[model samples]
Target: MALMTIPLIIFLFPLAYSPGPGNMFFAANGARFGFKSTLKANIGYHIATFIVTYLLGIGFGVGVSYSPTLMLIIRYVGVLYVVYIAWGLIRAGITKRNQSAKHASFIDGVVLLVLNPKAYIIIALMFSQFQPSTIDPQFYFIIGWISAVFTLNNMIAFFFWTVLGDKIVGLFRDKTKAHILNFILGSMLLVVAAWMAYN
Candidate 1:
């Protein structure tokens, strides 16, 4: 059990920190709105992540992993979302480069978690890496606790960006830079969604 800790920390931390739908949305929202207003979205996002992880940790993840029908649904939805977001980013970049439009709202963040295959995938991958063959098999419980820890790390990681975003936009008071940043962030979400679709 203790041996699994190091591997879990190393792998999960990087994966959590790296930009995904949640982080991208965090950046987009944080840039558009201040960190104070973004806390609600942050809580919502973490809750979604935890729910996804909890489901996957408890073996529900295999459904998405093996079911072709389910996988296809995820694929099409993800691709369509990616295309939509990509189009938004390009348009914002070209036309509304100076406007601070509220692109990703709270509902948008929650829906992204549902549509995000990466959330489930990460849970499945990390859960697979930990061995649960103890004599009493209590390792499963350990995994659950560790999953919470990962969730905490995610909160801090996102909070950091949200705070930094606050400073950046506050110092500049420039909508152009924020719009451009959001466009790039939206593009990143599109890439993530596309990658999830392809996978």
Candidate 2:
């Protein structure tokens, strides 16, 4: 059980807490859309893992690394999207209107999972590092257990950020206040984008 916990934690750590495109996307979703909107994103993330994880498992990373160009494209796309999301987040936060929440849709969440380069690389690496043996019932058991962990962890983490976004956005009650928030978030996004692009 202890050994099982360590491997599970390794998988959980990168997915649940890393600062990749998925994290930024979910964080932005939380800020714009209520946690409910974030639900799809959280689900999409694991669905993606379900596809990639069970396929090549640990071997995917080696193949991905060979194609540096693909990584480059994904990295740049992530940077650009992050900037766009930052604008929306700022806008939602500053708007004084008592309008509906500011979350992206399920499709948005799906795309985020698709676009998130960090998630792919990290999960690929983790899969590569760990393996489920044919004879090992423990391996399959761990999968069921890990699935539960990822679900709960994402729900909690996504809610925390989304709630924070909702509250922050609530502060500005009008168009003027919204514009202010927009500017700040947009500017922050610009800086982050530059860092992503450069890095």
Candidate 3:
């Protein structure tokens, strides 16, 4: 288990750090609301992430994974949810006072993970690659460890993205520049939604 630590980190680093729905969501929220305001959402996201990933690792998610109909429903729902968030960001960008924009809530984070198809796929892939073939006394322990690590990695990545967003917004004192940045972030989210739907 000790030897696997470095490999696990290596495998998860790129996946966690790379821009995706989760990263973008945090980034946009961080830009609009600042890092401290986004803490609840971050906590909610990781809590859901750890639970879901652990369940998947233990074979609980296997049943859901096999159901194409359920998967399709989740995919479409996630796409729609993302679109909704994107619309909010775009709408906020049009307004002169960004303070009117509402920060993402804890429920929003949980729902994001619950509906996200990509999250399921990634967890499935991670378990397939890392889970031991033979069950043992330590099997559950190992799964829990992996799940914790994955959650931690994601937390760090999201924090970085959130800080990056805050920093970017901090650089621009002009409202126009801030609005443009919001527009771009919102557009990027829309593109991510499209990609999710298509893929």
The number of clashing residue pairs in each candidate reads: 0, 13, 0
Candidate number of the best lDDT: 3
Q: Model 1: residues >4 Å from true position, as ranges?
A: 1-3, 82-106, 134-140, 175-179
Tens digits of lDDT, candidate 2, 22-134: 55555555544445666766676666655554444434445554477987887788777877777666555444333465446666766665665655665555555555655
Which one is best on TM-score?
3
Give stretches of model 2 more than 4 Å off.
10-15, 56-62, 87-103, 132-152
Candidate 1 residue lDDT tens string, 1-199:
5676767778888887887666766665565566766776677767887877766666667788668899689867866775676566546532221335554556666677677766766777777776364525675677577678778877888887777665655543455764676566677777877676677
How do the residues 41-74 of candidate 3 rate in per-residue lDDT, one tens digit apiece?
8899999999999998888889767688988899
Model 3 residue pairs with clashes:
none
Assess every candidate by TM-score. Answer: 0.76, 0.70, 0.94
Ten residues in a row with the worst lDDT in model 2? 94-103
Evaluate residue 132 in candidate 1 and report its C-alpha lDDT on the 0 to 100 scale. Answer: 63
lDDT of 2: 0.60
Judge candidate 1 against the unseen true structure and give its global Cα lDDT, from 0 to 1: 0.68
